[model samples]
Target chain A: MAPQPKHLSGDKAAINEFLDQFDVFLLDCDGVLWSGDNLFPGTVETLELLRSKGKQVVFVTNNSTKSRADYQKKLTSMGIPSSVDEIFASAYSSAIYISRILKVPPPRNKVYVLGESGIETELKSEGIEFIGGTDPSYRRDITPEDYKGIADGSLLDDNVGIVLAGLDFHVNYLKLSHAYHYLARGAKFLATNTDSTLPSNHTFFPGAGSISIPLINMTGQQPTALGKPSQAMMDSIEGKFQFDRKRTCMVGDRLDTDIRFGIEGKLGGTLAVLTGVSKKEEWDAEGAPVIPAFYVEKLSDLMG
Target chain B: MAPQPKHLSGDKAAINEFLDQFDVFLLDCDGVLWSGDNLFPGTVETLELLRSKGKQVVFVTNNSTKSRADYQKKLTSMGIPSSVDEIFASAYSSAIYISRILKVPPPRNKVYVLGESGIETELKSEGIEFIGGTDPSYRRDITPEDYKGIADGSLLDDNVGIVLAGLDFHVNYLKLSHAYHYLARGAKFLATNTDSTLPSNHTFFPGAGSISIPLINMTGQQPTALGKPSQAMMDSIEGKFQFDRKRTCMVGDRLDTDIRFGIEGKLGGTLAVLTGVSKKEEWDAEGAPVIPAFYVEKLSDLMG
Candidate 1:
């Protein structure tokens, strides 16, 4: 039962009053802070204002395509100073949680990584053997045939303990087929997120989330998503930030993922920004169950 | 609850005795008469025997991919003689039912077809103007870009009265995009079936039913399905074949489509065949609420 858009006015005073109650802010990166390279208006001043008020702020992104180091660098280049500790990507969460679940000594089990270099690098840092179709030199395009070979046991001489699916654009038939094979053979299937489509430029493109569905259907197995909206990610954030759920707030633009995470995590308040993903008219037409506590045109409107 | 497989002991006399009471046999094709190109063993003989015994046999295939004429040719080539009148494909049902619903004279309104040429041919014969894209040359490869252009109003200029989706292997991004655009713009979206997969060789391929989902998700509009298991198809069969529901039975192999159709249509009975999609072990493991009346390994088992 999300609040009606009419209830969330664009008044600066109302928006600031809503933000004043929360001590910690968890923000989504892609749709809320920035669309791609360009940062959303008033993002920097908003964070500065929050920090000035002694409130904690952390950036959380579900894009498992990149590592925290990369995100940190990118944010710095965009004039938004962020530390490696302040950034949480789904890839990092997946690596940490999956490693803990296996409980195997470092470098013992081989992981079939169907994702970006960030995932591969993370596994390597954790002493796990990472195997994927794409070469490390030019990791952009991995053919479906490579994926098929890995899935059908042509590539693996030993048993794989995990199959990690993250963000990749070149995902095709062979990859999906191979992923299904390994998944059916009892390998743990881990998906980074469940956002079917990601915003790109002016249009929408199929994201890693959409690619995981075919394999999920074929295997008849639900992959454990190690990303935002999952309880694990929320716990990880709360544990690291040392923030009480009742005093923290999640602010994002998407209803299905961002707002859903807020409601499911039982955060103090959920805020919906009108700057991305969903439009006011569409929100009014199809109301969601997870209502935002406040609405704002930009995060900069938040005060101490 | 579907009939127990243990009841079918491969005894011919027992199977025949069970089927004798039914006046009409409505059979589904894909998983019943044949899977892919090969007809299930003894299927033709069983239909012939049933017809010889004055038990009306009608081939009811939900494969909207082909026309009645195509089915007639395919069946005749398989040594099973059947007229177009005795064969009902979903495409024919959709055209007829939709035409009546729209109250348009046959062949008057232009239909944008996103299916096989069989559907286009049927609509054309009935005087409907085929608008979108049609290759009478029987070219099998049509890109999603072609369909996207049609759906986005880039390829065609005429007002499309209906958009029909069937099985197309060349289904791609553009086709789905265009279909969604046209559907969102108030064009009627009529789907061929709701089956998630279609039998292909010994494996399964994504069917038109699965392909329709993304479009449905994007537009948030429910398209009328014109295939088996739908009440409309059942009603059409009953009206055309003059089969009494209290005495007629649906004989097919697939539990979800065939047996469910019988239960939903309120047919007298359902005969689950082990030679097709469902196996005896599955029937035994998880019981169905609308049980089949009998179970047989093959169609000829009923001819004793």
Candidate 2:
């Protein structure tokens, strides 16, 4: 059985000690600060508490539907001040991986996107050439003749060396078919994240990872997932911020991604909040996959 | 390692002996008889040989894009005369499963389809009500306001009891999102077939199974597959035709679906043809999952 986390709902001394233990605090959005658009009371004050204590805060998110600037705008609109640099969204991670890491060269340097504007925005900010996302030309349904064309490679752009997948609101079979053909022709497959469901409006919906399920199912190959719990994204975060692992703490509502991200990265601590996908019983269960260092009823409980 | 099958090429006596072994010939259409629109040289003759010998021929296909009548028409066009009743398509199996077995009571009797018109036609023929497949209203992209509607159950049809998925050319996030919400609302998930790839135009494309991949990823539930390799489909075929399992022979070009279906159904024998997705080297590998009883260079080789 995994060890129990210290429930610090009313323990002022333990909470204070916890606050003093970390110089850097990595927080997950969505569930921790808000449930969809309804921001929890004292959520901003909770972040302020971390910041007022001289802690470096990075808003780590797996949502690939929005770029770093878009996320910053969302945060600002929600009354939580944030900057693009402090945001490490999966789309941004994928963008950096494509630009600075993969370095796909000329003629075949363009990317075929199977996602929404956020991924496109991130790639644009990185000055990367891309196609297919929100493009009207690729929005139409695939025809029977298209299959023959796809098979014959006549309906494809030869310059697309990589296929970037993310959460796409307008995702359809047309984009999927083109992406499948490109991958079959030796294009690299990359995904912003593989988080199957997106939590929004106090409910779960299909996430960015679900968009790539068909390709993964068809190709029998998994794409490079640059999201939370992936060490690649963690390495990117560490490189960008240069934070000491021993003095950094992770806080989030989900265990599989946020908590796992912290634990696997060998961070100082992981704090689980109850307003999200996971609960205390999950970590308390026998032979639990992950156990956080501390538990709070909600982020507002940190004020106590 | 599995024992290799008898190479039944250039052996007239062996071919005749094999031909006389079964009363019913279960043939896979796409790979064994034809590749896409281009029919093999002796496909009609091959079927004629089985028929002349008083053997029952059933066209068992995993394609859900066309109805049994449509398949019969395609066969007629190819000069291989076929009856609608002699076809056991995945869409037909799913319809029968819904109309006969599940028998979902009214108010929740209507099914939401995430497939092509074939599934719609089969469901219509079976006197089952279904919505969403090729519906102009369901073809639009989901907007931001749609999320709240999806969560609160305002955007969903309350009468939807099942979500039948198959090969859909117009598959989009709109249909998938609605299907996810319906599945979350306790709708039974059903798939025509889970064949990962479709053999078409002498190449492979995303199969009906790929249409359900996103839903499977989101729901974390495997839909009841009413297609090839599922014993339910085998039972449906047996109940419809009354063919003795011991006197039934399965012939196909794929190992995973056709051969596995025959082997698992305890059919008399399985013959592997070289004109399809699987190769002879597959069953020849160490500890091969399935090995056919015999192999022929092509379906025409049965004349040897």
Candidate 3:
């Protein structure tokens, strides 16, 4: 466990003092900006205040189910105008990492994707061939039986180089079994995010983290998590923005994912909010990993 | 770790001599009888030999996906002929235990099943009302939106006494979230088994054990696992058959499930067999639990 940082309480004066120190703001989506469809009170005012002070804000979400285009649309409809480039999604981060690290030479190798169209589109855009056993056209038509051929090694004969696990609606036993087989055969296993659960309408639902964790436990193999709270996400930010690590802050709700990510990535500091998936009582009850540098009632509280 | 038995070895002749002392057989399915489709060679001969010597045998499988009838059919197809009454499935065991322990008035109490038809059928047969949520019937038509109504305590208005988790085909985030809610609200959390993996067509698939373990970890709650390898299963056998625990031998292929069950239940001895889920190399590897009383190449090796 890392040392806890001094926390500025949710009081107006303390929050304003903490916000004045950061130049760049990296915010988490579901738990920080909004929970599903409902935005935290005063989110718009907070963003306006942050921008007024010349702080570059990026909406980073681990949910690979939605593309950047989808997030941009959602944010716009929610009274927050965000550009596509400003929205950094796990799918985009994973694609960039795969393209750079495991670059198969031109006439790129086929990838067996167990993910949504966001991942499919990203892989295609990167000059990678997608060899899908399930119906590529119909999103929910992929069943466990479809991937049985892959598990038995028949699908890999066509130069399949990587097994990418993002968010697939049709994830089943066979797909997981096949992914394990391909991974055992030295194929790279790239997961979009390690968020165990995703926010739904009322409660959290199992995400890519739940599925990927089991495979990792069974095969004794760990896939590179390319989503927020991973260091890879921070690396992407640092590489692209040329921002000073000690000057950037990760502001989010969930302690396990957001705050831990900030601490592990060696980011400047973390600001935890109480308006999302996690509550103050729950957060305090279970001793949080690293104490946030600041705590606020909502994002707007950051500017007093 | 328990003390290693004196006659334990991966030898054929020594195993045969040791098997002559037992008159009652308690067999675990996944690792003992067969793994996936391939039947362990000499299993049928071993069973026939036991029956010839007036030994009573009972097949106990912790997999709650199927009923005793399903196991009967599966075992019969694989050359192991046994009636439904002769086999004990976890679904049946769970239902029996729940009915006996809870002692809810007939047709009054409701059970939320996070399992398959086997559990539902058994609960219904016991005159317990089945509160439907995420099963095969509802999962096909319902989206994440439909789950909000059930999870937030709207649908559970009546007397929901227990939350039974067995083998669910649609064990999604929504169902698990709802189950957690019910459990937190003083409802009983009863699981079918704790075996992490089950034998599939050609390999091991994630079982109820994997699903239940995570929930247990998350909730900091230990559920009553009414399945084989549990002390409850062994007690059920002793109560029903009036069998002497000191003279009975539990035969299985896996050390964690089968051999451990026998030792923990204080049964006489255990027979470990090869040609199933557990390999000799795995057993020989470091840090495994107590060795079986006898280890054979196959079940039939005990007859000679």
| TM-score leader | 2
lDDT of 3 by residue, A77-143 (tens): 8889778878788877777777766677644356777777777666666666776434433334335
- Fnat for model 1 comes to 0.00
Give the per-residue lDDT digits (tens) of candidate 2, residues A106-160.
9998999988788898899989999898899888877888887888988888999
Ranked by TM-score from best down, the candidates are: 2, 3, 1
Candidates 1 and 3 compared by DockQ, better number = 3
Ranking according to lDDT, highest score first: 2, 3, 1
Roughly what TM-score does model 1 have, to 2 decimal places? 0.73
- Candidate 3 residue-wise lDDT, B8-105, digit = tens: 34565665566667778998876677777778777788788888888889898887877777778899889888877678888878777777665666
Best by lDDT: 2
Estimate the TM-score of every prediction: 0.73, 0.97, 0.86
Write model 1 residue lDDT over B1-304, tens digit each, in one string.
4445435546766766666768988887766777767877787787877888898778888777788899899888877888899887888877776665554443335566777778876776566766543453322323555444543457653466577777654343444545555665667778877666556535544566655655655556777887877777887676577788978888888777788888799887888877777776665666445467677777766665
In candidate 2 the C-alpha lDDT for residue A69 amounts to 87
What is the C-alpha lDDT profile of model 2 across B178-286, one tens digit per residue? 8999998899999999877777766777788778988998998899999888887887788789999989999999898899999999999999999988998898899
> Candidate 3 clash total?
0
Q: Every model's Cα RMSD, please? A: 6.2, 1.6, 3.9
Pairwise TM-score winner, candidates 1 and 3: 3
Cα deviation of A230 in candidate 2 (Å)?
1.2
TM accuracy, model 3: 0.86
